[model samples]
Target: MSNLTDMEIFARVVSAGSMSAAGREMNLSPAVISKRIRRLEDKLGTRLLQRTTRQIAMTESGLGFYERVVAILASVEEAEAFVSRGSAQARGTLKVAAPTSFGRLHIAPHLGDFLSQNPDLSVSLDLDDGFVDIVGEGYDLAIRIAELSDSSLVARKLAPVHRILVASPAYIAKFGVPASIEDMAENHVCLAAANQDPWRLMGPEGVVTVRTGAPVKTNSSEVVRECLLAGVGIALRSTWDIGPELRDGRLRLILPQYRASKDVGLHAVYPSRRFLPAKVRVFIDYFAGLYGASPYWDTGLETWLGPVEEARAS
Candidate 1:
């Protein structure tokens, strides 16, 4: 349609935050971009963007229009690519969201192989330590490490992540390892992030909530990990996030019998599975293969299960 070009220009301007930047990206002059937007507004009879010297922001109607436009544009491009290629090699771009710590330490490192395998496909990964609306924000996929809520999106269990209590050896040596759950309250400074409270541990017998005060609190898990590694305090973290440190003996587990909360687990969520692109499917499969049975959470489960099965057979 005649107005689709204007809609695309408007979307680009909003994405780039300025007409000049959008112009540069689109290989057009700022004046041309402005004129196109003006024509679009004339056609729609609504002001979509509030233009200023420094930045261009979307109006309420503009925001709504932009959302629809983005989805339509993406679908069109996907259709064109599918028709052109006639194969599973996905073209265009993939927009992904993930937690900051996990993205940096785990997902980012593996992206190279994915990119290399799919030459036509490109990715834009956003790493933020906050909940993101995948559909509303136009994200193709989200790698989440949390207890998934009931949603329309389809989700696949990627791996099990154990939430474990840990502290540096130096801190344990100075404070003395707490043998019982009650002693942890008196001995350990509980380091937490994002206003999270001290973890509650459950064992065979009963439940115990360890009340701990944090001298240093941050919103970043990476910062919390650093503080724990620096002997600042005892902290609870996901096993997938601290496997290397645990293996290297930089941090030691405490009260191994008391299991930390298992509520949060790793998941790969997408809009649907019916038409899952090859790239997304391959990535999910790769992640599952990499951490399925011998996941970071399976610290003692494999060894314990093996003996139990052997004894049952005997």
Candidate 2:
């Protein structure tokens, strides 16, 4: 029997659940359907299905093989479409949601180049701090900076973000630098938006929760940085967001000994679909190429500012 005919028969049998049902769908006799399945099983040297009078079920290996067949069929269809279309020029609106700070600082700055590259592609960026439903809210993609939870959504790691505790030199001068996590409670004032808690620092010794009287609170990191520059209070924030400020001496590291949670990761999350759109894939690939290896966030402020400070001192 031809491979194509065998595959069609196998697929029909799997979908229809019984040889008789598959025969009815294909307008063939039940005996013919059973014979085709037997030939396929002989070629593969595997028992593809467990047949009973009541119902038909695939064996464990049979299910795995079926999954591969589905993927192969999909790829074949995609290849045909690509060949027919000549080029995969994605022409559609790409809606994206991202955190305000990351969107403004990272994505917004680079989006112009992407738009220029794909002239037909129109992008709408919704910048918000809160989580937005990519499927329900109708966003094609969302850039998130957090620990990912187990979900059906496809999350691709674009970059790594390091959260650092920082304060203004003036604030540190007024209330000495914290030597340990414990010192933060007495010496530092926490600056975070409503509903967000101050970061807890953990080291080899133990864990320490830094509590503070609310000195300044803002939803935007840009606002937080503004307040920090104005000598409001110390804040634990992503290093990528504040590298320039720290390099310029607008902000100083608070507790060098204790480190905040190092688990902050940058993800490009999108709703899972049978076929991912080319535009979404292109953007994700571009983002990964740009930021995957060494994200600006992973570059600590100390690395960028240490030389500048040395030069100033010299």
Tens digits of per-residue lDDT for model 2, 202-287: 55555566665565655666777777777778787777788877877888876554556435588999876577666677788878
Pairs with backbone N, CA or C atoms under 3 Å apart (clashes), candidate 2 = none
Predicted structure 2: clash tally: 0
* Alpha-carbon RMSD to native, per candidate: 5.4, 10.0
lDDT minimum window of 10 residues, candidate 2: 305-314
Per-residue error for 264 in candidate 2, Å, reads 1.7
Model 1, position 70: C-alpha lDDT score: 66
Residue 278 lDDT in candidate 1: 59
| Model 1 vs. true fold: TM | 0.72
Off by over 4 Å in 2: 1-84, 297-314
Off by over 4 Å in 1: 27-47, 92-97, 122-142, 148-157, 198-211, 214-219, 245-250, 257-262, 268-285, 292-314
Best by the lDDT measure: 1
TM-score of each: 0.72, 0.68
Clashing pairs in 1: none
**lDDT tens readout by residue for model 1, 1-314:** 76878888988888788999999999999999999999989888999989988898888889778766765666666566677778556666778899898888778887888778778778899998888887556687899987788976789888766676788998987887887777777766888786567576665455567776778757777888899999988887777777777877898877666665445678988874345665566677877776675685456434322332232233
